[model samples]
Target: MSIEHDAHASGRPAITEGGPSLPQERRLVTAIPGPRSQEMFARKRSAVPPGIGTTLPVFVTHAGGGVVVDADGNSLIDFGSGIAVTTVGNAAPRVVERVRRQVGDFTHTCFMVTPYESYVEVCEKLNALTPGDHEKRSFLVNSGAEAVENAVKVARHATGRQAVVVFDHGYHGRTLLTMTLTAKNMPYKQGFGPYAPEVYRMPMAYPFRWPGGAENCAAEALAQVTDAIDKQIGAHNVAAIVIEPIQGEGGFIEPARGFLPGLLEYARANGIVFVADEVQTGFARTGHLFACEDEGLVPDIICTAKGIAGGLPLAAVTGRAELLDAVHVGGLGGTYGGNPLACEAALAVLETIEADGLVERARRIGDLMLPRLRALAERFDVVGDVRGRGAMTAIELVVPGSAEPDAAVTGEVARRCHAEGLLVLTAGTYGNVLRFLPPLSISDALVDEGLSILEKAISSV
Candidate 1:
């Protein structure tokens, strides 16, 4: 295979403003898992547990903009932004600068012991940026699961209710409580038994798979959800109704229009806190700053992570001030919840997103990728559906002439893309959806190249 370094291939600049200035092109100098990566994989198998799986197993030496450079010098177009953690791009200049300064000043003072300005600043940013204009309080954590766990804790504490309502096809986290809340069984929660209690499941407005056609999905789903809550869990006993605006692991399923609003109204009327899990859809990845903003759905609480800190391990739960304040002082905190370094990186990430116009960049990415994906759907019978918003997009794979999921074809396409030097990811409840989470800093040329690789992979499959 041959590699090109031209920026004009897709009529967009190759240079990234706040990220590493790599050539922004794909280059293959060896097989997918080159010698070095394979060697590292061997060591990883011994050192790491088999449970910790890898996507491509290509050891990355450096990654920036739209490309991840491997140890053997193979550069692959990054369609998955470290699972949507590097929205502003890896090693973003501002993040690097801020992290360096914070590391030099103080690494970890433990926010619970002695809070720092950066931590407070990050909370302030979260309070300001999250969905509602109502006064809100924010709590920081180390991961999405922690944010979610804390959100549930706050909701339960505020409402004095034990039951938590979760929707089908939602991916909360791997924690015991969140695992029970999540709908998927395999990989995330198969052997992990004796799960948390008081977690009730509800139907979601999955348009493609709805019993009625897509047109009637929202109303029907809403009715079913409300009815289920009333009959199964009793709305009065529910503490929170947690949902992902765009179900990430559940195949990037964006509920039909009005679905979220309907749920929010129900939650409000029933005194159930509505929690929007934006772990995968937040921080400008979905055109709007948060996917909830698209529907103008002001959730009672919003959980965020991934792109919040430019790849750092930081997550936050921002919600109405009264609810959050309901928790007793010192009741919500962690040893390394809001490390100074991570807080600094988050502040820089927010600034970079605003100054670099990453939100618009995400929309541009969707504009460039969605049409080509839809075209691929037209060409390939296996392409069941192509849907998403902004940079967070996906194509569902299904058996031809039917909606039955084809996980085999999905795996094959991803494998082929890996061999051809394109980094892609698969998602969905059935593992038949190919999700694309390209960095907001990716160039048009790289986007075109990645899509080309994906097209060939899908065709070959």
Candidate 2:
């Protein structure tokens, strides 16, 4: 059921006279995981596997703006937009309208079995909206990992090389190939090996945790990467260099300046394709449409998903025409790869972003979040570092007077927030980075209030 708005907000949600609307306020009416949620969770414990994790055990009944109303009737302030999937907000008016119409018209014909105009139009949109202006082509998939795997296929097919380079602290996805591409070991890749072959790991230019110093991160990391490729794998044998412009699951780690451009130059010189895995940082979630745009990067291939379709499962691999076209017919696709409903949702999402100036909105979110978090850093000894851009901001928690991560404290802080009706998330190699991804539809008042809750949570912890 699509909820209508009061029509008075800045994001300008589609208004209707009467409906059960989501109020943009944080209200706690019961315990975090109150009786009703506990009942559902007990059933989940019996039916669901332990492998599937839950960030907050509170089951949601409805969500919109900056609020997620759980089964217990608790309205929690949303700082995590369903892991950055709902950039336009959950049940967005545009997405709801388009998807509802698409569902009525046709659910699925399978793009491969029967062609559709929406798929072709989405590809065209990807070509125009992505960082490159070069002639390009795109194919859709069901998730980010699938898009990445296809991108690698395109790279290998075009270049006739097998070696693919990935960075430390990078996360591609959970599928077999992408799990192998991911850097974390415990949750994502522990028992999933023997992993994909010919995938190499490179040191990230993570300024805060860089070995030598922040100032030397760019040059040294680039040098180390080039040296690693030349000696370990041989540049001529490499097919693609894949990276997250701003490392997502890896602590929102923004590489130091000059690192990405240097890598691109090296790849171009070495005949290797550059693939930017913009799964989390694309679609105006970052201040720019793509985070790579911050450095004027033009990747040979770019993958996007998270915020693409306003919560629908959709991902795309957009790259140079020569590369994607190099694959033989039927090399890339899935049954639900550009499902009409998801395609319509993606189109509507793009429309919302452009119309609402979400790119600027993302910048404003960053402007609102970074300062408050930095202020927290000043006052709290547990805060090791504060970083991120646009709506994707986070703080690294560490033991006072040392760089060692305080995962225990991080967990406690997150628990405190959840208990108080504020939904937050944790990440990082050490599990100490507290991340925030407020919806672009979130109001200034909600953002301020959420940050207040965050501050209180941190202080109490």
Candidate 3:
């Protein structure tokens, strides 16, 4: 019944940078997937694994700013950002320029074998930009999952402990170790059992679905986590407590105000490391360089990716020096961990974020979206809740009279949006949330048009 805002999530309007020269417009030239995409889908059915799924199989030939152009010539307004991977926009001018140059110079020479200055420079930037002013260290990896796994390894190595704690509705990743850390079941953890050991789950302060009500969510959720950690895992046994500042695949859920700080306090009080998995929330997606900066909640380790490198596959684990240093010299690394092309792309992403003032742009996006979604909620009873910070917003769909999730309706609305040439993504644990992650480079005109299409889609449904 109570609604609060993060004061840090508002600012002056932003002047976004230019990225991807593709014309930004929505034009549905054919049926949703189009014939070319259909052909590709048929090929995929024969060639690819069933486990690998897709939201819209439009067969993208080009993407930039706010539009993803399909092979059939349809230009769909993009609100998904390739699952929030292209925050600076796909084929961002800076990224393309840097990577094109880097590719000609050299591609891979793995950081471990030869090492590169770009890699070291990236670590320096991460150490400086991530939360906390303490002496920090950073190492690059290939994906968010790898960053999280490295964070866990660093925590365990530093604390000399065995157990790790995660929260309900939190999504880490799909790797064996991260799969064990994740809380979801069906798609992520169902048959992939015989999971790794020593990971515990805590209740997240998810206000909308908390047991009693939103008001009690913060206090109760905090108590439950501490109690569970103390009684079940024993405080001393916990090496790290990992959580997303804002849950992404598990439905962009932003925990109540007091919960994160409370958890951080407990972690510090015990000798347990606190890891902030900022994969989806980092890089100005949440109106701040890091989501933890909103509450001033500094974690011992922060995992970043998705938006870190425009569209490159790069991730990082930045943390207190002692923890990262605790890992043996060769304890952490991968064949493609800090590939030079990715490193160049990451540096370009950082430059683009700072130059474009994307943090302010994300704030402007939230200012534009939250009010519109809230107004839509008032018009439609199926809109159970509208929550998110900055451009990373979501609307939780529900049965008309109650909080029961309406995943069916969510799917239908998404399908409608696709048919109308609007690219949107559905998320949440129950799969009833529609999350929007527009590239910050997108013009306000495109954002308005996308929202209009979404409104029409919801109305039609």
Q: For each candidate, what is the lDDT?
A: 0.90, 0.90, 0.88
Give per-residue CA lDDT, model 1, range 1-461, as digits (tens).
Answer: 11113432443644544447566778999998999999999999999999999999999989887889999999999999899999988888889989998888888889888778988899898898887789999989999999999999999999999999888889999999999999999998999999999998888899999989999999999999999999988999999999999999999999999999999999999999999999999999999999999999999999999999998999999999999999998899989999889999999899878876777778888999999999999999999899999999999999999999999989999999999999999999999999999988787878998999999888777
Put down candidate 2 lDDT per residue, 186-271, tens digits, no spaces.
89998878999999999999998888999999999999999999999999999999999999999999999999999999999999
Query: Whole-model lDDT for model 2 versus the true structure?
Result: 0.90
- Alpha-carbon deviation at 281 in model 1, angstroms: 0.4
> Residue 244 lDDT in model 2?
95
lDDT of 2 at 413: 93
TM-score of each: 0.97, 0.96, 0.96
- The stretch of ten residues in a row with the least summed lDDT in candidate 3 is 1-10
lDDT of 3 by residue, 1-461 (tens): 00012322432223234345577678888998999999999999999999999888889999877788999999989898888899887888788889999999998888889988999999999999998899999999999999999999899888889899998888999999999988889899999899999988888899999987999998999998899888988999999999999999999998999889988998899998999999999999999989999999989999999999988899999999988887888999999998899999999989878766778888888888999999999999999999999999999999999999999999999999888898899998999999999888776777888889889988998
